[model samples]
Target: MNVKLILSTFLFGGLIIFNVNALPASLIERDGDTSLGTWQIVGESGVNAMHAFLVSARKVVFVDKLEGNALKRPDGISAISAEYDLDKNEARPLSIYTNTFCSAGAWLGNGTLVEAGGDNGDANFRSGRQTVRVYDQSIGDWYELEGIMPSMRWYPTMLSLPSGNVLVVGGSKAATGINKEAINNPTYTYYPPSGTVMEDYPLQFLAETLPNNLYPMVHVMPNFEGKPIIFLHANQRSISFDLGSGKVVFEYPKLPGAFRNYPLTGTSVILPLSSIDNYNARFMICGGNKAYEITSEGEASCGILDLMAENAEWEMNDFGGTPRVMPDATFLVDGTILFVNGARTGFAGYRKGGGANALWVNENPVLFPVLYDSYAKTFKPLASSIVPRMYHSVSTLVPDGTVLVTGSNPQGGVSLNVKYPTEYRVEIFSPPYLFSNTPRPNIISLQTFEINKERIKVYYQQIVTLIVQVAGGEPSFKASLIHHGFITHSQNMGQRFVWLDVVNVWMDTTVTDQYIVTVLLPPNSNIIAPGPSFIYLMNYDAPAYSGVEVLLNEQPA
Candidate 1:
């Protein structure tokens, strides 16, 4: 990739700059200290089927059922507020709001939340109506907005435009109920001449302008230039809505190679322009079931589509792993798309137990398929989650770069109790490490440093010293020491960089894989008690990405 080309059209404020310098896989983690990994359990009941939204201010929020029976008030879908720590290896919880059993919701920029179709007792209360909820973060509560649709909807597509307007599209509204009218009647939500607006806005909107009667998939374009486009997978149609003027552009491109079932809705991600072609914008869609077995492999469809040019269409492509539907895909800071936790086959259910054509079983393994845009044609099998997850909510990169993954079917949802479990638990992947997972030998045992009060001379030594300290994963000793505080001068060398574990300096001069190095304390040195000093004795190996060993005084044996 050209550096000039990369810097020219940077997104999110040039947060990621392409450099000619090669990146080492081991140290590939995002910008944060690996030592401070933190995660707080926000909801305790196993939340398996939930959705997440990122606030305009970059806060991550989601709604999930509480613990116990899958259906219950207060236990229904609630709002969870969290902040990410770029340096720490974890996420800390801020607040949670609950009022309905929401299946999906989206951030309306200014901390407002727009949710569609959730169960709220009486079976016909909202009647599949589209409800908008505004949450005040400062107060940690929720306010119900007045405009209620006549029908009920679940898992509908909702997006907030850059212009601060909100767009709600097709979803499975109740087949019958009070809100059912909302779904049956599209004119109530769209603009005049097309549809009527129930709520008063600074501007008048038409319902027909929206993708009425369709559960559209809305994704914001990268570089923050284009308006939010809604892909009505239900009708195999796509529409671009310009909120500025309340206009809609239509494009009907039948995806080639497969006949999609009733619900064409699938997950779509904005891939880098270079992934599919040298020119124009490209996106990857995955996890939709087909009525007919189209491919020879019986694998579901996985392909790329060009969204920037005219007559945009889907092009078949290679998949690094098994076909997953409703999988949660997130864009890694390194330009990699990570797909985790999704069902193997169809919408029917989990593919567990012994079956001739099981989509996935325990032995089949639930793995993390990482698609590196740099390696567009190939998908790499990365580490799997500690637990198997399906229909889960995975968060995009926080400012710190760690992915926050939560919720999922505990075990294929085979057990009745396991269905749609809510998860207060979450996990994060530390950035990749440069070195393979090989245990480093304790060649240099003295991994600690301290100051003595007798003070005239500084003393340092290692508990175990090996002859080949600078070999293989051994530390090297060049006698370079760094002190965080204090000063060094001729009368008393200013605080100098010193290593206590480094034993000797004599070693192979040619080898560069220095892992650890130790050194002895200088003579006649004034010692500062409680003040810590660090000495690094290594051949010349660059710092490991993480899991760095730091020696501290009075710490342990």
Candidate 2:
């Protein structure tokens, strides 16, 4: 029996919903068991989460484009900035004066989320269009950075560079009217107001990619020589750009078939790096489409490229499972990738002139989650979700190893009559590890020394010890720094994963039942970019991860 066929039948045949409180241990022990993972409808988000990021270990901040009175929102709210507390399962509304629709953001070294540019709506055009807003997660406050960006950007992409600065890439001057003739700002600028900016950089590449390349897949990887280079891919084209001089180092071979960017939305993840591979980097792009017709099938092809190889070319792999569009692939703490959300047919977004049911062309929602094993090069379909996360939906891996899946608004505004109506319900997918009877390793404390009398910093190549209490056998742990990117429009800008080097592991002599794990930080910023990274500890089985500890890598200024 084909596993995909059986899994599809199990999903469509109304699989029993397992009680969140009473998950069986047998279900958990099924390692790499797709059926063992389960989903629980935790709570409802009051607003549609067009964009989402894990602000803290316990809190998630979700935002949607400004809808004014279209969607019933709290009074005086121009845009919904809802902070969802994972522990409490409660969402609280925060006031955002600017319209943050189609904006881009990345976490700064200070652990503050810096979002730049947004919609050009009339309501808050002055503040929203060109505004740069920063949110302090520690204080639950928002601050505006005045006069930062050089232009008004909608549908822009923001990436955190290895230099601890953010690079803002291609965006249209206006919203959604993307075409060949549309005005596209093909240059990139820096955050924190870098005096020198690269204007008209790679203008032809962005122009040729056009409407489909709104959110380009950009990865900062070390080349064969270990120098940092930016890999920019959109649609069928890919280019390696040198960061220092703003020149194209090399143009990668075209993707085999179908487009993997916006409208034709797929998901991508930079495969986990390891010492065995000599830290050579590879990227995988999966599931997209070439057209927006209802009859158009979602692309089941996956393209991968090894950046460090001498003559690297995209290797295509066909997944004989469900074809998905607008999917979200989140890199889990254990180095496995969790693929969720998106639709089976039709492109992203709602139809402008179609009738009620046909408002959103993407009908079949890929409810089942797939786990991609980078090492094994295989896809395992996991538990299915009842919610249909298409169009503007977003998903991110929480600190505790659960995937927080939210949002799906195909309509331009709130409409109950549409087929795939606007969704505010938030669901949490508990991976097989969470179902295990074995207790997770608990982090007792993280020891860090103060630098510059201003902030705590983890120095490069220094051994850092984390005190953790293990419940069962001797602990064999892995340290990972997962950067949960600002997710919007199928592009997770600045999303990255770095498997930290383990120096030593031994039991704590002073404290019984407790052990100390010593890990070496990346030798330089090029290997693992310096900024805010969520550090997680996973034991031998890789079953569950301890709550994340935010680590800042900084050299004293």
Error of 1 at 164 (Å): 1.1
Residue-wise C-alpha lDDT for candidate 2, range 446-533, written one tens digit per residue: 6643211222356666667777776654545667767788898777877887777666666655565577667666656666666666
Q: Distance from true position, residue 518, model 1, in Å?
A: 40
lDDT of 2 at 86: 90
lDDT of 2 at 157: 80
Candidate 2 structure, TM-score to reference:
0.88
| Candidate 2: count of backbone clashes, pairs at least 3 residues apart or interchain | 0
Residues 1-557 of candidate 1 have per-residue lDDT tens digits of 11111122212211222232432234233454423233333333233325554332134444443323232335343223333333342334433333234334443323245554444433323322455565564554445543365445443455433333445544444432112334432321321112454432221122332222233445443222333333333324445544445455555465554322112224555453221232234556555545322221222566676666677766776445576544556554334556555545443222344344433321222446454453446666665555545433454433233455665543333244332333445565533421223222223333332221111122322233222222243222222223221100000001112223233333334444323222433221112111223332222323211111222222224
Best model number under lDDT: 2
Per-model CA lDDT versus the true structure: 0.37, 0.72
TM-score of each: 0.54, 0.88
